[model samples]
Target: MKMLLLRYSTAFICAVFIITGAVSGEDKAVGQTVSFRPDKIVTPVSSIIWKHRSSTGSVVKAIEWDVDDGDNIPNPRFKGITTLDQKTGEITITKLTVEHSGVYTIDINSKEHEQRFTLNVMERVPKPEITIEESSNPDVVYLRCAYSEKIIWKKSSGETLNGMKNQDPGEFITVKNTRNPENFYTCTLKNAVSEEISDPVTERELFGTGEDKAVGQTVSFRPDKIVPPVSSIIWKHRSSTGSVIKVIEWDAEDGDNIPNPRFKGITTLDEKTGEITITKLTVEHSGVYTIDINGKEHEQRFTLTVMERVSKPKMTIEVSSNPDVVYLRCAYSEKIIWKNSSGETLEGKKNHELGEFITVENTGNPENFYTCTLKNAVSEEISDPVSEREIFRTGEDKAVGQTVSFRPDKIVTPVSSIIWKHRSSTGSVVKAIEWDVDDGDNIPNPRFKGITTLDRKTGQITITNLIIEHSGVYTIDINSKEQEQRFTLTVMERVPKPKMTIEVSSNPDVAYLRCAYNEMIIWKNSSGETLNGTKNHDPGEYIMVKNTRNPENFYTCTLKNAVSEEISDPVTEREIFGTGSNAGMIVAIVIVVFIVIAVIAIVLSYLIMKTVHESVNNICPCIPNIFGPLDCLLKKTDREPKNSAPNDVASPLNETAP
Candidate 1:
C-alpha cells in the first residue's frame, strides 16, 4: 500500500508539470499585435470563452460567444483592441501595451483547450552612442557606450569586435589608435523585443579625411594642431605634377593675403587656427593642400580632386528593322547605367546588348519604362523615362481636302537633322521635306514644294491644301534614326451641290430638265420618291426629267459621293414650263415690235423724201448737183436771155411763195 501511494503521487505531479509546460509565450514590442488560438477546431455551434490574467495576478473574463448569443466583451478596455473569431476560436489583440501583457486562455464548449499564450510587451531599446574619452596614453582612446540595456559593439563590416557577441552592461571600452583610414565602429542597444543601432563613426573623421569636390562646391581644410597666438600662417597647394602654389598668407599684423589669382575672390583663411576654406571650386583647383603655422608645416595634408559636374543626359530612341527591337542611346559619358521604372538596375549583357547604345527587345508593354544615367566620380545625371510605345504610333483616316499634320509621339528638341519621306500608293518613295542645322528646310519633291512645312524643333510636318495624291504613308527620321510609325492617310472626295436646268423641244408641250454635278445624282419628286433617269454625257454629271404642268409636282436633284451629299433647290414642273414659254413669248414680242417700228420708219422716210423732191422742183425746177453747184442757178446767173422763160416762171412762183 505504501508503494502504490508513492507511485500515484509521483504520477500526479508529473502530469501537472506536463500540463503547465504546454502553455506558449512570446516577446512582442509595444504597438504590435498578438494572437491566441484554440488547439481544437471550433464549430458554429460550439461555445467559446476567453480569459486573461494580468501582470498583477488578477484574472478576468474578456470575451464570451456561442451559437445562440453572438459575442460579448465584458471589459470596455479591450473593446476596440481585441477581436474574436467564432468559427476558428482565435483571439487577436492589437496595439498591445505593457499593462495588457498577461496569460491568455480560451475555453471551447465549456472545456479549456491545451493551447495557451503568454504575451510580454516591451518598449524598444534606446539607441546606443559611442562617446570618446581621452586616455592617459597618447595613442589610445576609450569609446564609451550609453544605453540602459545590453550593448553590442561592431565594426563597419557588421562583425562583432574581438568575437564578442553581447557584452555585459558596461560603460566604456579601451581602443588603440590604428591610424588606418578605413577604420570605423558602431554600437547597438539590443533587448528581447527590439534593437537600435547608432550611426557609424570613422577614425578618419577624428583625424582628417581627403575630399573630392565638383565645380561650384565649397571645401574647408583644418590642420591637425595649432599653437595659440600663432605668429604666421601660410596655406599652400601642390598640384599632382609637383608644382607648388601659395594659396594663402596671413600674419598677426599684416592680415590675410591670397597670391593665386584663381583663389583671389573665393578663398578665405583663419589666422589663429591656420585653417583655410576655398569656395566655388574649379577643376583647376584640384591638388594636395596643406597649412603652415609659425614657420612649421601642419602634420596632415589633404588631397582634393575637383572634377566637372556631369552634363544633363539626353535620350534618343532608334527603332530596328525588326518590330520587336529598339535601341536607346544616352548622351556620351565615360560610365553609363540603365534602370527600369521600378528603380532596379538592369544587367548589362543579360538584359540589354551594349554597344555605342543599349539595345532592348520591345515586349509590347508600355509600363516597362527605361532611364539612362551618366555618371562620373563627382556627379550623375539621369535621362527622362522612355518606353517603346512612345516611339511608334498608328495611322489616321482623313478627308481629301483637309490640311493634315503628322506629329511624332516623342519630339527631340534642338534637332540637328531631320528628314521626312513619303511612300506613294504605287510603292514609290520620295523625300518630302528635309532640314539640318547646317542647311535650312529643303523640299525635294515638287509636289510638296509650296505645301509642306517642317518644324525644326519638334520634327513635325504639316501639309496644307491636301490632295488625293497625298493619301499615302508618311514617315520621319530624326538624327539619322528612322521612325517606325507611319502616317497612313486615306483621302475621300466630297460631293458638290447640284444645279437643275430646263431645255425645250420643238413641240410646245415637251421640255427636258437636266441636273448638273460631277457625282452620282438622285432625282426626287415633291412626294420624296427616287426617279430613274437616262445617263447624260458624262458619268454622274447629268440627269434627265420630263416637264409636268402640275404646280405641286416639284423635283429635286441630290448629288452624292462616298463621303458627302448635297441637294439642289426644289423646282416645280410648272416653273420649268413657264420658263420655256415665257422665254419664247418674250423673243417673239421683241421681234414683232422691232419689225413694226422699222416699217413705219421706212414709210415716213419715203413720204418725206417725195415731199422734199416736190418742194425742190417747185422752188428751182432743177435737180440738185452731186459734185458741183446747181446748174439752173448757175445758168440763170450766167445768161438772162437763155433763161427768160425760167425767170418769168420763177417770178410768178416767188410771188406766190412770198
Candidate 2:
C-alpha cells in the first residue's frame, strides 16, 4: 500500500521560521481553509509565540500556553479570529476572511518547534447568472447560467428544471405555460469547494410576486390598504383563461350576503365587515379575486395564489412491442414532467391524462437515468432519478479467464448509425463500427484495436481472450432515432481436475485424502458422503477417513473455481496403507514348505523300497524291513505320476506383490 504524506502540514512548519526569522510568503486560494499542525509537541510549553511579517518586526513570545486563551498579537486582525489547540500545537483560522490574509508564524518557545503559514486568499469566481437569449419568438428562449462551479435551474417555485450536477454550463428549458409560466426560471449558484456564498438566481425570473408562503397557512384577500364603504364590497374571481367568475357579494345596507356554491363550505365571511377568509387553501383555489365597491369607482384585486404539497410521482418502465424500444409511464393527479440526464426536457406535459404514458427514445449520453418531477400551479416536488431495467443480457457469467459474446435482440432496417460501448464510471467509451449518418463506419476506440471483433451486419461482438477487468456491462446504441440498449458480459477462468493422493499415518487403520487445487476442494466417498476436512483459512485440501482391512474404502476429490469445476478419480485406502494380513499369509507359506519337504522324503523312501524289492533276490531279505512304510507310499506315488517325473513342472502356488 502507498502512504499519504502530510506535505501541507509539513510546509507550514517551514513557513513559520521563514516569516519570523527568514523571508518570503506562500500563496493560497481565497475561499479555501488553511490549517497547520506540528506532528509532535513538547509538553509544559513555557510561552506562546505569534508574529505576522508586515505587522510585527520582532518575534513576540508573550502569551502563555493555556486551554482557554488565543493569540496575543499587537495586530488586532488575528486576536480573537484564531484558535489554538494547546496540546496539539495546531493553529486554525476557522475561515479565511479578508482581514486574515497574511503571513503568520507560531513557535513553542524555541527555534526547534516553530511553524509558519501564508495566506494569499484568491477571490471567488462569481455568483451564477442566467442570461436569457430569446429566439425569433418569445415562446422559444435560450438561457445560459454560469459564473459558478455548478449550475442548477429551478422554477421560481423551487422545482428544479434540469438534473445537471457537473462543472459544465447548464442546459436551457423551454416553457410550455403548464407547470410554469413556461419561460421564467431561477438558477442556483454553487461553488463546491468555496467557503462562502450559496445563492439562487432570483433576478432571472419571478417565481411568485415576491411573497412566498408555505402550505397549510391561512391567506387573506382583505383590502386593508384601501377601505371602501360597507355597502359597496362585492368579491369577484378571475380565471387564468381571461374569464370573470363570481365569488361572494356583500351589501351591508341591503343585508344581502351571498357566496359562490364552490366556496360555500370552505369560505368564512365576517358579515359586519367586508372581509373574506379561506380556512384551508389548495392548488385548486389559486387565482385572482377582485373586490369592487358599488357606488364608488374603487376596486382591489388580490392574486390569491395558493400552494399544496404533492407526493413523489410514480414511474414504470416496460419493453415495448419492438425489442429496441422502451416505454416510461408516470402518473400524478397534478402536473407531471420528465427531464433527461443533461437537464433537457425529453417527454413531459402539465396535465397528463390518468392512463396516458410517455414514450422516449434513448440517447447516446454516458448516463442512462431519467427523472420524473411532480408539480402544481404553485410548488414542485423532487424525485430520485431512475434508470431503465436491464431486461436483456448476454448469457456470459463473468470469471478470470474466459471468452464472452453478445448480440442485439432486434435490428431495424436502413440502419444509419450504431454506437457500441462498454460501461465505465467516468463515461461509456464509444466503440462504434459506424458513426456517419449516410456513409458507413470503420473501427473506433483504439483500446479494442485487435482484442475484439464485430460483425457490421448484425452488430455482434466476440471478444477473444477475456480478463477479469473485462467483467462488466456492454451496450449498443443503434440508429440515431432508436433506443439505446445494453447486454452484460462476464468472463471466467477454467480450473482443471485436481490430483488426489491418499496418505497413511503411523497407525495402519487411518488414512488421509489430499487434493491439489487453487480455488476450492472437497472430498467424498463413492456413496456421495462428504468427509470432514481440515479447516483452513485458504482452500483446504486434506480430509481424514477410517482405513479398514476391506479394500473397498475409496475417496473422491472435487475442485472448483468461480465458473468451472473438476472431479478426481477414486483412491482406495488399501492402495495407500497395507491391509495388516501379512502374518496370515506367512503361515500359509510355511505350511506349503513343510508339505513339500514331507512329499520329497516319502518319494525318496518309496524309490529305495522299489529298488530293494527288485534286487531282493540278489542282495539280502531285510530290505523289506528298511523300506516297509515307504513301500505303501511308493504304490501311491506310482498312480500319481504315470510318467516317472515331468521334465518341466508347473508351480502349485502363484505369488503377487502387496
Q: Of the candidates shown, which would achieve the greatest TM-score relative to the real structure?
A: 1
Candidate 2, TM-score vs. the true structure? 0.31
lDDT of 2 by residue, 295-345 (tens): 453344455555666787767777778543577667676666778666776
In order, the Cα lDDT scores of the candidates are: 0.75, 0.58
Question: On residues 34-126, what C-alpha lDDT tens digit does candidate 1 reach at each position?
Answer: 888766674644688899889889988788888788888898757888889887788888888887788888888888877668889999887
Residue 423 lDDT in candidate 2: 64
What does the lDDT read for residue 619 in candidate 2? 26
Model 2, which residues run further than 4 Å from truth?
Answer: 1-100, 103-117, 120-221, 225-229, 241-248, 257-270, 276-287, 297-300, 304-373, 378-396, 400-658
* Candidate 1 Cα deviation (angstroms), residue 364: 2.9
Where model 1 places Cα greater than 4 Å from the true spot, the runs are: 1-27, 30-123, 130-212, 215-229, 238-246, 250-284, 296-303, 314-368, 376-378, 390-658
Weakest lDDT window of 10 consecutive positions for candidate 2:
203-212
